[model samples]
Target: MHFSLFLGPGVRGPHEDRPAIDLMIEQAVAADAAGFTAVYVGEQHFNNYEPYADGLTMAAFLAGRLPNAYLGTSVVPLVLHHPLFLVERANLLDQLTGGRFILGMSGGRPREGKTWHKHDLTPEQRSRLFDQKLDVMLRAWAHRAGDQPLEFTTDDEYGVMEGRMMPASYRRPHPLFAIGTNTPAKIAEAGRKGQKVHLGPFDPAGAGRIAALYRDSMVEGGHPAELIEDNLRWLIHTKIILVGETDDEAWDVAERLFTGPMVMAPWIRRDPGQDGWSLRKIYRADPGPFAPAMGVPESQGAFLHRTAIVGSPETVAAELAGYRDAGLPHVHARFIFGTLDDPEVFRRSFRLFTDEVMPRLGVETIPGPAGDQVQIF
Candidate 1:
């Protein structure tokens, strides 16, 4: 049951009252102190409105800020960059962090391709590009692994492979690679590559079904049968966690901050012709002329109560048993979502979660305040 500090930062929101760069740095430091296993940030550079234009840059900032805990991207949109460039930068980041880095990549949306890609590729083209780019990046890492600089190109030609990757990645066989996906085929593909994966929070039925799909495919893909379970352990289920001393308190905060405009900020600026328009409308319905609007049903109090764990420490621990039953080995806890503006509040919520919920969930914590024993970064 490894815990992680997950952040999906957007350009708009009340949290943006403070500059995003500063807030993320502060958030990373807090996670390290709280004994979180890792800190993951997103790359949502859909527009000038999106806060994190470059994930590796933020990954570097976090690597510098935290004494412990990993720094990783929610995803690097691989279709947007050359394989060599992405591999070099990521390997360098891993070296700088002393191997405490995780690499995650995604196929960018169509609108993003129109804006940033060298050519206007369709979604299918971008997906192919993602596969090709990632294939080259992995090969580059493998080439760097042996310090090999052989001039001959392989079946999959990566243009201009002149020199070995300097400061070779610290992680053996390269740092952990996680493929982001929402489909069963992609899940199987990630397993075929023996890479990790990221999926959204799902109910027991959904989670169990997905897990079964990945396991069966991994075995069929010639992944070592014995190691299939080990690989599945790398499946990170993302969820928003908001717990306090009491159920009422936790529920109130999650209901208030994690909804409506704050939750919808990331998609508001997207091209209307794309998926963002549907989301904008779905999340836009709650606002009114004289009243504070709530967000889309997904983030609202009732929906979240079922989909996410939002309760007191005791309740959170109990609800998590279902996830454990479904064989989820890890969860990326999003304590810093929506309009959670105050750092103290974030610290308090995380501390309460660590202090109480973690123990019941089989993780042992030394009885004391967060960062009391840990070195300040």
Candidate 2:
């Protein structure tokens, strides 16, 4: 099983501010040393909230620093990028990482279009655009100099032309492809193409259902049953906060991190009775008291117990085992979320997991300490 870490560039806010790119470099070094198999950086733009605007760029930087660790994007919003350019960037990063790169693509959120003054595309449009972009990217990666032309159409006009993408990916036929979505149709589409699917929001029950759905769809779509067993990789991303000695301590840390100014800078407005609101709505809401308070200590404690891998290493390992039993092939830990900015806290939790949890699961550590600098393999 692969153990991955999901790191955001940085959240917005003066008090919750992170150091600089240098800090990210340090964090990558730490992750590599702590024995993480891979690292995924999420992409965000416009808002000072998320420092990393280009996941490909960050992946390249980390690849240079940690040659042994796989680098990937949690999900790039393909609708916001020109397909050809996105492909080029992906290809270059894959080459730089010596094939240890996975590309995850997503349709941009409707609110993002409004932020950029672009027309808000419908779900069908986004789906079609995602399909087309994938086709172009795959074609660019697969074609050879004398092979078939890379062709695509935009606005009903077709164009055909291309040499192979420069800095061709080290992986044959390009690096792995992953689609991130909560919908069954999207998950089925990915399975039909033999692509990996990332499951989310820390819901194990939902993840199990989605994984089963993908496998079932793969068989229904004429893929061999063995194909599902061989090619499918299940990645679950979850929020986590580990406490050293007491549950209260863990709750305290979670509240501070989640409520930190940087994380909540663009506060999310929650309905009085609803659990939470989406980030898009949060960004659009006025900064009034109506903006929901961060999860209380007790509520947070319940959340951690329910959705996160927290507590001592033994406890965390047990929780992880439950996920494995549920059929997760990879688990992506969101160690840094909201305000959890203390380097010491991050390193300690990472160390505990690597030293105790990972070995118990019989997975090999990627090799290194928590913050050692790396070079691309």
Candidate 3:
């Protein structure tokens, strides 16, 4: 199994003045030096949750710094940009990264309202537009594979290509494609099309079923055996990870690291008008007077137990072994997130995991540590 680093947005308190981008750079550089397989970044806008506003831009910048590891977007919102522009940028990254780029995409952030979109597109409209855009992008790339370039039209955009797409991708056809989805239909369709699916932090027990659905559907859809094997080899899942000298120490630190600022930032700022409002409201219920009024501590505890892998090196290895045994081929470790202020703590835990735990996984990793090799500008 491959272990990669995922850089998500974090909360910076009022007194914390360091740029979030710097932290992202630090994490990516460290991952590269540590011999990680890949580094993925998240895209966020308007909200201060994510470190960067654009995933591709961050990936491009980090690609230069991370020569040893593959770079990809955890997911770029496909519906927000022109398909043609996205194709150009993705192809550029493919060339620049020496074909070590994966374009992970998603439908736009429907929860953020339409403020960032050019028009007020409903969720259904956005989903349809996403499909149309993907179709156009793939068709354009198909020209490189000897397919005739034909005229294409989306809801508000149309274009015709007379020849091969400009600055052809480094990889034939295009860079590897991935999408983050929980819907079985979407997962199966991605399998049919030979793209990867990111099963984000879902329950491990269900992951086997999802993985089976993907591979079984791929076989049923008549995709080649090599394609199915490669997809299975790179099938992605996410887990929040923290390691310590002992399991108890890890959980204690997790309660401190993920409890107050970590959980509250997103919960308080989330779109109340969107789905799961009532469920979130219960977690944010009134603690009454004379109590620490905030998101429920027990809720975060339960969340850590289910979603995060907080334990000693031995424990972490065992938990991850279960994932590998369950047929997950990739694990994206989220070492940084909201309100985790101490970079040194992150570094220590990351080093411990790399030095002690990864060896037991029996997966290939770059040798040696890259301490202080991180560059900043």
Choose the strongest candidate by lDDT: 3
Q: Considering TM-score, which of the candidate structures 1 and 3 is the better prediction for this target?
A: 3
Candidate 3 structure quality by residue, lDDT tens digits, 148-169: 6578899868877676666777
Model 2 TM-score?
0.79
Candidate 2 segments exceeding 4 Å error: 14-20, 115-119, 155-158, 222-227, 241-243, 261-307, 364-377
- lDDT for predicted candidate 2 compared with the true structure: 0.63
Tally clashes: model 3.
2
TM-score of 3: 0.82
On TM-score, who's better, 1 or 2?
2
Model 1 C-alpha lDDT per residue in residues 271-336, reported as the tens digit of each score: 334343332242234422211111223332223332457678888888777787787757777766
Candidate 2, residue 22: lDDT: 52
Of 2 and 3, the candidate ranking higher by lDDT = 3
Q: Give the per-residue lDDT of model 2 (tens digit) for 1-377.
A: 66777776355544444463455667678777776777888777666544767778778778788867878787888777777777778878877877677787887666677765546677787788777777777777667777777778753235786666676666666666678776778888777777777655444555566667787778877877655765454444544545344444555555556565344333232446434743223323442322111232223223333345546666667767767777675777766555445666766666666776778776743332222222222
Please give the lDDT score at residue 341 for candidate 1: 51
lDDT of each: 0.65, 0.63, 0.71
